[model samples]
Target: MRLQTDNDMVGKRWRSRALTDDEFDALSAASPEGGFQQTAAMRRMVEQEGAAQTELVGLVDADDKPIAGAMVAYTQGRFGLEGSIWLGPLCDAHNEHLLTAMTMALHVAAHKRGAISVSCWPDDVYLRRTSDGEPDGEPDDLLVGNYEKLGWHHAGFDRGYGSIVNRWVYVKDLSGFKSADDLLKSYSKNTRRNVKIARNSAVHVRRLDRDELGVFHHICELSSVKQHFQNRDLAYFEGVWDAFGDRAEFMVAEIHLDEYLAGWQDKYAKFAREADRLEAALPESKYPDDVRKKLDTARRNVESAEHRIADAKERIERDGHVVPAAAGLFMWHERELVYFSSGSDERYAKFYAPTAIQHEMMSRCLERGLHRYNFYGISGVFDDPDDPGRGVLEFKQGFNGYVEELPGEFTLPVDRIRYGLKAAAAAVLHH
Candidate 1:
C-alpha cells in the first residue's frame, strides 16, 4: 500500500488504499455488484498478457474492510501512461458517496503512478430496456449528472457499439425459475423447437479439456469469418483458462456420427411402419378421407426421415465418428454466469448446436442457484431489420431476456497539465 488518504464525507470518515489479492477477492465475493471483471483472476490475466500493469484500488471503512473498489489496468500510450477502469468500481453504483470517494481514489492512485489520466467504463445501468431496446421506464439521468459533477467527463449516450465496453447488453433473470422445464417454458416457440431439434438430433454438450482449446478456437475462427467479427488469439483464451481454473468453462456441442446415423435410421423405420399401417387401414375404413390424410402425412414423414438418414450416412463417412458443431466459453462468478465468446461450424448449423450449448449452460446455472445470466453485448439498434446486428439481437431475444443500457465511458484527468497537453495533441492529429 503506497499512499493512504483520510477523508470525511457525510459526517463519516473513509480511507483509500491499495488492496491485496485476498482482500479484493473477499470484497468482490461479498458484493452483489461484483463481477468477473473485478476479480483477482482478471488481474492475473492482465499480468499474463504483459501489456498493462494492474492495480487493485479500494475505498475502505475504519475497520479496513473494502466498501468499494476497482481493478485498474495501466498501459503506456503515445500520450502517456493511461489507466482504464473496466466494468467497475464494484460497489452499489447508486451510492453517490462511495462513487465520489472511488473517483478521488482513482485520481490519487493514477497520479501517484505518473499517469496523465484515467478512463473508466463503469458497469452500471443507465436505462432499463425491453428486449427490443425500447425503454421500459425512464432513464437514469441523475447518474450521468453525478459522474459529471465528480469531475469525470461523460460520453453522451450513443447508438451502436462505439466504446471499449458495450453500452448495451442482454441479460436474463433466472431467479424465478426452479427447474429446467420452468426455464424452457419462458423461451420463444422457435427457440424451444430448435433446442428440441438439437437434442433429438443426438447433439451432446460436454466440457472440453484445456488441450482441446484449439478445437474451440477453430470453431470460433470459422464463425468469426462468416459473421465479420474480430476474434481473440489462442493465447488470450489460454490465459483465461489458466487464471480462472474451474470458474471458466469451454463447452462444445458434438455429435457421434455413427449414433446420429442410427437414430435417423430408426426414425425412418418408425415413420415407414406408421405410413404402411395407415395405408393398409384406409381401404376398409368408413372414414376413408381422414385415413387418407393421415396416410399422406405419415408418408411425408417417412420421406423426410429417409432424406435425413441419407444425409447422416454421408456425414459419417466424410467427417469420421465424431464431429464438433459449436463451441462456447462461459465464465462463472458467484453473482452470475457470463456467456463469453462462442463459435459454430456453419456446415453443421442445421444441428442447432449453439441452442443446445446455451440450454446446457443455463441448466447448470440454475443448479448453482445463480440469479442472473449475462448474454453479453449487442448493438443498440433494435428496430432496424437491415442493421448488421439484427441477427445477433434476434438470437439472444429468442431466449426471453431484457436489455441494459449502461452509461458510456468517462475520463478523469489526473494531472491537468499533462492531460491537457495530450488532449491537444490528439485533437491536432485527428484534424
Candidate 2:
C-alpha cells in the first residue's frame, strides 16, 4: 500500500504545540466563564505556591504558542506531598481528548517540577474501573480517570469536613497512604442563633472593588490578627478584585431592623435603662435582692446586642453589602448556589450575619433554581472546645448545612523510585 501523501490525518485541527504563562493568561482573560483572571493573583498564587514549594510550570506551542498549563506542588518536601500543582482553575474547551491531555499535562508539569508523583482533588475527572470495578479513567470525562489509566495507584475516596466542600481534603498516596471517608458523615445538631438570624434577615449583594477592599480588608485584618494569621497585601486583594469580574461580589444585608425592629431594640434598652435608673436611685443597701439580679440580666443582654446593631447600621450606610449577618461567598454552579466563605461584623454577632447571609442566599439560590447552597469550609479544630478558633467553627455550625463527604485528594506515581527515596529522606529528616 502506498504511504499517505499528506500528514493531515492526525487531528482535524493541526497539532500545534502547547501554551506558556502569558498565553495562558490571555486565553483565560478572554474566556466568558473564567474566574479571577487578574495577573497579580496568578503571580501571587505562583509566589505562594512557591513558598509552599510548588513547581509552577507554564508551557507553549512549537512556534511559541501557549495552549495548555498546570502546576506541581510538593508538600512537606515528601514524595507524598509532591503532586500536580494547581490553585483550582479550569478554563479550556473541556471536551474528551483535551481533557485527557490536561491530565497528561498534569503529569508533565509535576514531573518537571521535581515531583516523582503528583496529587490532586478528584475534580470530576473520569476514572476507569478495573475488572474488580474500581473507577479508572480515559481522561474523557475527568482528570482522576487519566491518572488510573496511566498506572497511577488509587488511594480511594474521602470528604470535606466543613460547611463548603472546597476545603475538603483527599489523599492518594503513590507512596502508600490514603485518607478515606470514615472521616466524613454529616452535620451536628449544635447550631447558634446568629445562623438563623442571618438566614432570615433581609440583605443585598453586590460585587465590590479596590475602593471597598480597604474596609473589607480592615475587617479581615482585624479578624486575622486577632486570630493570629498572616494576611496578604493590597496588591493581592486587587488581583482578586479584578479576576472575579461579575463572579466576585460582596453582600450587604440591610437588617433594616425596620422602625419596628428598631423600636423593639429601643424598648429593650429602655427597660434596662429604667432598671439602671432604679438601681442608681436606690442605694445598694436599699435595693431588693431580686432587683439586682434582674437588672444585671438586662444589662448583659443589651451589652451583647449593642455591637450587632451598630454593625448593621454601618454596613447599610457605608457598605451596602450586608447579609442577615451570616454572609459569605455564594458559589453558583448549574442553578446550585454554594455558601463558600463567610464572616460577621463583631458589632452584630448578636444579629447573626452568618445566619442571615446563609439563609437569605439559600432562598435566593433556590429561587434561582439552584439545588444546593454550600457552606464552604469548617474548622476541624474543635477537638478542643476551648480552642480560640472554636468560636469560628461555632459560627459556621449555626447555619445547619448538610455535611457532604466529597471525595478528597488522590495521586499517581511518576518516578516511583525517586519519590520513594524522597519520602524516606523526608520522614527520617522530619522524624
Candidate 3:
C-alpha cells in the first residue's frame, strides 16, 4: 500500500507496508503507549483462534524505520466486513504529519482488503488532561480534530457499556509512592479497612503459573454466574497466558482453612465467655433489659462463630489446606501496569478477597517501580445511582485514582453503500 496523505505532508517521504513479526515486536515494545493488545503475539492469538485475520501495518520514514504502526484485526461484523479494529495505535502523539500519513495509509490498506469501514481507538497517551486528571475538554478536542481532518468521523462519546472500546478508564499514578504503606495511605478508608480485613482473615495472594489456569477459570466461572456476565472459555485464557508470557501474571487469592478455622474458634471462645459473664450479671445489672439483650446478642455471635468453624473444618477435611477465593490477570508494559481482567468467588465475598488481591498487585507494581497502574475500562457515568456500572466505578474509586475520558472511537468509511446495506440488514435481523 502506498502512502496516502494531504498536501501538507507532500514533502515528507512515507512508506506503508506489512511489518514482519520481529519488526512488529520491536516497534510495539518501543512504543510509549502500546500495551499487550498491540503486540504481535496478540495478533497471532487472534489468527490462531480463527476469529480474525491479523495485519501489522507500519508507516516507515525515508530510512525505512517505522514511525507509526497498528495491529489491525479483520473480522466479520454485523455490518459487512469490519477491518482494522485498532485497539491503540502506536505512534508519536506530537507528530501530526506522521499521524495523518499513518491514518491515511491504514484506511487505504483496509479498503484494498475489502473492508467496509475502519475504526480506531487511539492510545490514551495522546489525550490531554488537566493536573487534576479530568479530561482537559476543549484542549483535548485537538486530538480528535486531527483524525476528523484525516477523513475519520467521530463516533461520539460512548455512554453505554456495550459497544466500542476506550471511552473511559481509571488510572492510578504510582510515581510518587515509595512503598506499599505510602500507596495505602492514598486509598479510601473503606478500601484500607477491607484490605486489612482480608489480611487478618488469612487470605493469601500469590502468582499462578500457566499450569494453574484451571483454578483461575473456576473462580472466574463463579464470579460470572454471580455478576450476570458471560465467562470466556478456558481456551481463550490459555491463549492469553501463552501470548503475553513473562509480561503477564495471574494472581489468585486463597484462604488457608486451618488458620481461618482456628481464628473462628478463638472468636467463638471469646464470645462464649463474654455471653456467660453478661448472663450471670443480667439480673443484678441496673439496666436489666439492656444487659439481657446484650447477653442474647453475644450468645448469637458465639453460635455463628461456631458454625463458621465447623464449616471451615469440614471444607479442610474434604478440599485440603487452601481454598481459592479470587483471581486477577495483570499486564506490565514499560512503566505502566494494567489490570486486564479479574474475578472473585461470591462465596468468599465476605472475606474481601478481591480487594486483597488488588492490594497485592498494587504492591508488586510499586516494587517494580512502575509509574502508573491502570484499572482498565469503566463507564464514565458515575452520578446516576442506578447505573449498572456504578458499583464498578465505586470500587475503582476506592483506590483513589482519577477518571480518564479518552477522545473515544472514530471510523473511516471505505464502502458506504455496502456498509449501509449490511447495517440495515443487521438492524432488521435484530428487530
Candidate 4:
C-alpha cells in the first residue's frame, strides 16, 4: 500500500498510507487512549479469521511522522456490494485538524476499495475524576464534534446490551489509594462485607499462566450457559492472551476446603472456650437475664461455626485439595486497567469469588501505579429495576465507580446511492 496524499485541506498537507508493524506499534503507544486492539498482534489475529482485508493506515505529519492512524478490517461487498464494516479505529482525538484529515483520507481509501460506506467505533473517552475521587461525567465534545462535522452520522446507542462495543462504561480512580484497605474504603458497605466474606472463607486469587487458558475458558463456558449469553470459542481467548502478552492477565479464584475447614475449626474452639468461661463465671441467680443471653449467643455462634467446620471437612473429604470458583480477564495499557471479561461457577456463587478476584486485581493495579480501573461496559439505563443489565449496573455501582457515556458508533458514506441501497437491503433482510 503506497502513500495516498490529499492537498485540498487548507494550509495542511495530509497523507495516508499503510503503516509498518514498528510504525503502527509506536504510533499506538503514543496515542493517549490507544489499546491492544490497534496492535499488529491484533491485526494478525483478525487476519487468521480469513474473513476481511486488514490495513493499518497511518496519518502522517508534514515531517512524515505518523500522528494518527486506524486499524481497519474491511469486508469487501460481493456482487453489488455497497459498504464495509470497520471495527474499532485507534486515533488521537486531541488534534482536531489531524483527526479530520486522517478520517477523510480513510473514507477516500474505503471508497477506492469498493466500499460505499465506512463505519468506525472509536475508543471510549476517559472521564476525569472529581474531588471526591469519583469519575466525573465529562463528554468528549471535540472528538464527537469533529466526526459530526466531517459528515459522520451517529448510530443509536446500545440497547438490550447487544452491541459489539458498549457505549456506556463504569470506571474507578485508583490513583491516590496506597493500600488495599484504602481501596476497600471506596466501595459500598455491602461490597466491603462481601470482600471480607471471601477473604475469611479462604478463597485465594492469583493470575493464571498461558497454559491455564483452557481452565479459564471452561469457567467462561459454564457462566455463559447459566447466564444465557454467547461465549467466544477458545481460539478467540487464546488470541487475546497471545496478542496482549504481559499486558493481559487472567485471574482465577480458588478455594482450599481443608484450609477453610481448619480456620473455621479454630474459630469454633475459641468461641466454645469463651462461652464455657462466661457460663462458669455467671451464677444463675446473681446474673441478669441479659448477661445470661450473652453466654447463650456465644454458645450459638460456637454451634454455627462447628457446623460450618463439619460441612467443610465433608466437602474436603469428597472433593480435591483445590476447587476453582471464578475467573476474570484484564488488560492494562498506560494508566488504565480494564476488566474485560469474567466467569464463575454457579455452584460456587456462595463463595463470592468474583468480589475477591476483582479486589485483588484493583489492589495490584494500585501497587503497579495505574491511574484507573475500568469496569468496562454497563447499560446507561438505570431507571428500570427489571432491565436485563440492571444487575450488572448495580454490581458495578457497589464498587463506587462513576458512569461514562461515550459518543458511540458513527458511519460515513462515500457513495450516497450505494449506501442507500445497502441500507434498504439490510432493512429488508431484517424483516
The pairs that clash in candidate 3 are none
* Candidate 2 C-alpha lDDT tens digits along 109-205: 5656556776654333233222122334443334444445545555555321422124331111111112111111122333434443343444334
lDDT of candidate 4 over 1-431, digit per residue (tens): 11133236613665777889889878776676576667776677777777667778777778888877778777667434333332346666566566667677677777778777777777756354432225466656777777777777777555445356676777888878999999999999999999999998889998898888898999999989987899988888888887778888999999878789889989998999889888887886475687689899998999899889888877787767788889999988764788999899877777889999989999998888887888987767666788777877888888987776666778887788888887788889999
lDDT of 2 at 87: 28
TM-score of each: 0.95, 0.52, 0.85, 0.89
Pairs that collide in candidate 1 are: none
Q: Give the C-alpha miss distance for residue 402 in model 2, angstroms.
A: 2.1
**How many steric clashes between backbone atoms does each model show?**
0, 62, 0, 0
**Weakest lDDT window of 10 consecutive positions for candidate 3:** 1-10
Off by over 4 Å in 4: 1-7, 76-88, 92-96, 124-142, 415-417
**lDDT of each residue in 147-206, candidate 3, tens digit only:** 777777787766656354657778888889889989888899999999999988889999
Q: lDDT (CA) for every model shown?
A: 0.87, 0.46, 0.80, 0.77
How good is model 2 by TM-score? 0.52
By lDDT, is 1 or 3 better? 1
Poorly placed runs, candidate 1 (over 4 Å): 1-12, 429-431
Best by TM-score: 1
Say which prediction, candidate 2 or candidate 3, comes out ahead on lDDT. Answer: 3
Ranking of candidates on TM-score, top first: 1, 4, 3, 2
Candidate that would win on lDDT: 1
Candidate 4 local distance difference test against the native: 0.77
